[model samples]
Target: MKLESHQFIRYFEPEQAAQISQIAIIKKFNPREIIFEEGDDSDSLFLVLEGEVEVSKRSGEGNNYVVITSVKSNGYLGELGIIDRKPRSARVVTSQQTVLAKIYYESITEILANTKGDIVLQILSFLSQRLRTVTTDYVNQLAYKEKMTLIGEMVNTIIHDFRSPFTGIQLSSSMLKELYPDQESQEWCDLISMQVQRMLNMAEEVLAFSQGDTTLYCQLIDIAKLLQNFAKLNQVYIDFASVELIVSVEEGLIINADENKINRALQNLLSNAVEALDQSEGKIEIRARRKDQLVEITFSDNGPGIPQEIQDKLFEAFVSYGKQGGIGLGTAIVKTIIDAHDGKIFFESSPSTGTTFYLHFPIAKID
Candidate 1:
């Protein structure tokens, strides 16, 4: 019964199992490559020879794939499908570079017809245990989602209620800045005004993101068009300054998201990039492309890059570096907006290489 590493063949004659290996096809898959999808015709049963796979199942009622379990090296897939000659029951996607030994249904049937009854019982037992594991995973995932939803609602309520006080403070600081006549006192008022405005922005961003699905007006928005417009609108600024801006989004690349929110998040990033290069001339490149089932957008800057002081807390609210009158909420807000869309945001930067931020959003599911 110890099946790991093709050792299960002890149940049958070694010569027979070894003969089957000759006809067994070995296939390789790269990271994120889908081996098969649910409902696809199943012609073969696969045995993972190396690496790992994320096994998920899709129900007819839902548009998303619910993770069932992970199958590692030596695990078999589509056994039930092979036995019944039915469609694939689940999807198998590679978590990394992987190799699989595929035995066609024709080969399996031929071997089974000649094998003893115990062989069939062994296969049935393997599948039965796998079914139990998948059932448990689905139940646990549903419970986890429910708990997360409740926590999200509580956070949203708290953040939304904070907006009023932040707004009042923002207004009071603005009035104080105007009323103070002395240069030093006026500067202090300006600092308070800036901080208040930053907090207000943070509160608004948190509130907006916390609203979850309702906050996003999902539509098939063109990614290229958005970046083009962004560059066109900021053309004057780039032209007047001693800096260069490059936009390189592929035409027709689109995603499902809230257009206004995405545009705002990106604008804030660009503005921050420009302001960071205020003293020294720099270049910023915006690039986008299709990466698997997501569109990956990169914003790169050839300035001094993120300073060591604020690099760690760059995405945290209220963390700023040498920039005068900085709120440090821009990147934080950007992250919040992306997270609300079920997208991702990460960056890499150093003094020599500058900085680059990557944003990835799932492709729109066509109904």
Candidate 2:
């Protein structure tokens, strides 16, 4: 059966449904508003007419909340309270501006007396389905957590083993800088030293990620300088592939971010684009502009767009699709790095138009 605009209307005749609608008060909630909290008295059942809400439960220590599920349009909440007359079991907050039908306990009693439909049975079915979903999510989370823990330990061991060799490289680079004392030679030595440190930082980043954490060393970075350095580093590969790299940036634009991490993110995007082009007549464009209080950066490529199979889960770990030698963690790490900087990252792609990634960062304030 086709669903009516009001889900409750499907349970009763037109006249009764009209009465139910009249009795149910329409309520509006703003983003992040708390409709109810865990342990609160439940006097009404909320049926969502628009937008979304997050349902969460207090952690075992009661210090934080863990999101259980999100309820969107045409879904209902507080059904367990209506059926069992118990206090609310979860906290519900609006994820965006929302409209809900608030059906109070007194109104529910009136509907029960008149309606012949199996409303209670429907509520039971909904609850049963929700339970199964929660159980499955819990199991998956547990397994993934265990896997990450193992990865973290392995990463730590590898970093420890590499510590002596990294120290040797650092010492050798510093010695070369001192011995040469010439402009170009010193620059090369400095570059080698910086890259050696960046390698250690990258290893630590992976370890942190495995432990479900992000650590950043943020500094003011010149956007144009960063783009120039990126192009210089990849010039050899770009020339070999016969690809054109165009960079445009607003003068004096600056961003407060972890420079190494952001550079790594750009590298990942470039890698994907290069592999997609497969050394053909490809063009990649990098641009940065200031918008309000944010700095927006775009990386676009004229190549075959991303495959449809992995578009939805592009930012998820291990979601590589239609790529050769892709371990699938690039975009996922990029998202984590951007999120850690309190920035935003997204992409658009199509078969005819190719792919473009957008990154937005909070513009750094200078004294």
Candidate 3:
């Protein structure tokens, strides 16, 4: 884009615009290049001629920068430097190959000295608009932080309240196992105890996630065994739902992961599948295999697929479709757990067919 065609340049008379254009120095930058750093001596006003730039401010943590906004073609950056000689308050980086017209502080002052138009007011108006936008963003961020803090506190309180009952259940299940030494009875008692432990873990998981942490207690686990145990744990629900769950897991596949969290993630998928089936006769299939150096697992169900409107944001918090009384944190929690394990998750769905969620994890190194 030409400097003459710029809207900012049009704010001045033709003669003044020509004078400003004479002083403007065009510069080009490659993608991912830093144009300026926070705290650098502010000198020039950058008018974007091509591509885009990212504006970011140093985070409170001081180790990283949080992106505040993006300036695309025809937009302008560093307008504040034209008004004052203060240091740059934010960092600017090229989002892609970019071209910018740089007008130095001195050049702007010289142009203002010769200008007859209301150029000073035009610059001030730009600064005022930007300040308003930034202020609104800052306020919204504070409100979000406060809201999340309240949720964290509530989750911690609920977890504490549930701990005692979970303990009682665990003790009862242990006593049952001791009293009934028969294989079948002992199996039921063991399932009960395992379930009590899972409930406690689930409560803690919610608390930890609300506090923005997903601490993994990683261990080498047999993939086949994990899938088998998961199927067993949910056998009652599966039977009740009248769903045929087929598990096709390859043996000798191991992964380094948090067993409880992985189980919770799988349980969430199974729960959603059963709900999709609406207690009707349907099929749920889980398959696992070694794909290169990673273990690929798929959970699929032949129910009405995810709603088309929400497919793009399925993993985002508070996104739900065709569910009653769902707060929509299940898939969000699942993504967080998988990310903590350095794994990947994606899915395919069709209204005519069903939904299939794929999870991939690196194989655990055995020495």
Best by lDDT: 3
- Which regions of candidate 1 deviate over 4 angstroms? 1-4, 7-11, 59-63, 180-367
Task: State model 3's lDDT.
Answer: 0.86
For candidate 1, the TM-score is 0.50
Model 2: per-residue Cα lDDT over 90-121, one tens digit each: 89999998998888987876776776657646
The number of the candidate with the highest TM-score is 2
TM-score preference between candidates 1 and 2, better one: 2
Model 3 segments more than 4 A misplaced = 1-140
Q: Rank by lDDT, descending?
A: 3, 2, 1
Candidate 1 least-lDDT 10 residues: 1-10
Once fitted onto the true fold, the runs of candidate 2 whose alpha carbons sit more than 4 angstroms away are: 1-4, 8-10, 19-30, 33-43, 57-66, 85-91, 118-138, 210-219, 233-244, 280-282, 291-294, 322-327, 339-342, 362-367
Write the residue-wise lDDT of candidate 3 on 1-367 in tens digits.
9999887788788998998899899989999899999999889889999999998888677657666778888888887777778999889999889999999998887877777656767766867887788767666655545666676798788878888987888898888888889999999988988888887787778767766787888999999999999999899988988999999999899999999999989988888888888566699999999999999999998889999889999997667765788867789889999989989999999977798999999999999
Which run of 10 residues does model 3 get worst, by summed lDDT? 139-148
* Residue 57's lDDT in candidate 1: 74
- Return the TM-score for candidate 3, rounded to 2 decimals: 0.72
TM-score of every candidate relative to the true structure = 0.50, 0.80, 0.72
Q: Rank the candidates by TM-score, best first.
A: 2, 3, 1
TM-score of model 2 (CA atoms) = 0.80
- Tens digit of per-residue lDDT, candidate 1, span 1-367: 1233463344456766876777788888998899998888999888888889998877447666666778887677887776678888789899888888887888877887888788778866777887787789878766644654564576567657876786787688778777877888776666665555545544455445433333667789999888886676567667776679988877768798977678778877787777777535688999999999999999998766888877777876556753688645578778888887889999887878878999999987776
